[model samples]
Target: MVEVERLFFMGASQSSSSNSNGEVVFKTETPVQFSPTLVSQLADRQNASPVPTSERQSTLDDQIRAKIKDEVGKLRREEEAVQKQIHTALEKENLDRERDGAGELADGTDSGIGAVKSSAALMGDLEEIRGKIERFQVRKSLQDWPQVRESREKLVECYRSHKASSLECWKEVEGFKDSVRTLEKEYFKTLQ
Candidate 1:
């Protein structure tokens, strides 16, 4: 704890007097004291040792390179394992084909990947698919457009008859619109 006192100056009193030169003398009071307080945290950055920028960056780069090399090695090992599995599967398939008395591959090659086919076989498969499609495909019945044709003819006749007053063909135009709407409804029903 600390004690505090304030000082102030005023005109000279009876105890205080002006100097010989007739200048008014100023008087000072006791010193002012403040209460003790908590100290604040301070950062002494000047005393700290900092790592060099290039060194920090190089360390980060080395870590990244090591991680990449590890990942590459792992991927290469996985690829080799997959290759081995594929070769084993191919061997099993060849054994099966031999037991089934099958001759060479359809493409005439005995490679690792054995699914290549001749153009002739591909054409034969396409023809077979086409035959099946034709056999099972739904044949669209002919949509007789008699109503639409009649309405269209009527509209054309009305236009021709009233070339100067085409507004007189409004009934025929409405008839044609109704016919088209009906045709669209029937088309959608067939789709469903």
Candidate 2:
């Protein structure tokens, strides 16, 4: 469709208007039409640009990674808590057995570690620890059995010296967990 806009300038020649030679000159009216297609094309050009879906997806992926990392951090913290519990347990068992003198009793306290014969779950932990101990043993970190025996004697001496202290330590490491994994990294290092 043709759209016309009119602007009137009345009395151009008769109103003392002059030409380049200061002489009156007659002029005719001209028509101008606005093009709808050109206007629509200009607007469409702006809208035709691509959307940022890839950029948006990258932002979403980053958010997902951050959420996963947060969940993993929480799980790691829980795992550490469980390990500490196990450490305290083994330490107590070590002390009690020393006191009561257990030659070969198949303690039923930890069904997870039945009879010290390497039960399924405990065996895996034992194997992992054995690897670490092998490395530590190479480095001479863990004491020999004789030295451990001497240390056990000293532990008893300390227990005798302080009455409630041994029991206190036992309270922290109850159930004699019976798992080789009950040692913390630092204590395992000592075993090497």
C-alpha RMSD of each candidate structure in angstroms: 15.9, 22.4
Q: Which stretches of candidate 1 lie over 4 Å from their true place?
A: 1-143
Q: State the displacement of the C-alpha of residue 189, model 1, in Å, after optimal TM-score superposition.
A: 0.5
Evaluate candidate 1 by giving its C-alpha RMSD to the native, one decimal: 15.9
Highest-scoring model, lDDT: 1
lDDT by residue for model 1 (71-160), tens:
999999999999999999999886676644333465755544433244455588789989888865545322366889899999999999
Per-model C-alpha lDDT, please?
A: 0.73, 0.62
Report the Cα lDDT for residue 81, model 2.
Answer: 99
Which residue pairs show backbone clashes in model 2? 88-173, 141-192, 142-191, 142-192
Residue 53 in model 2: shift from native, Å? Answer: 0.7
- Clash-forming residue pairs, model 1: none
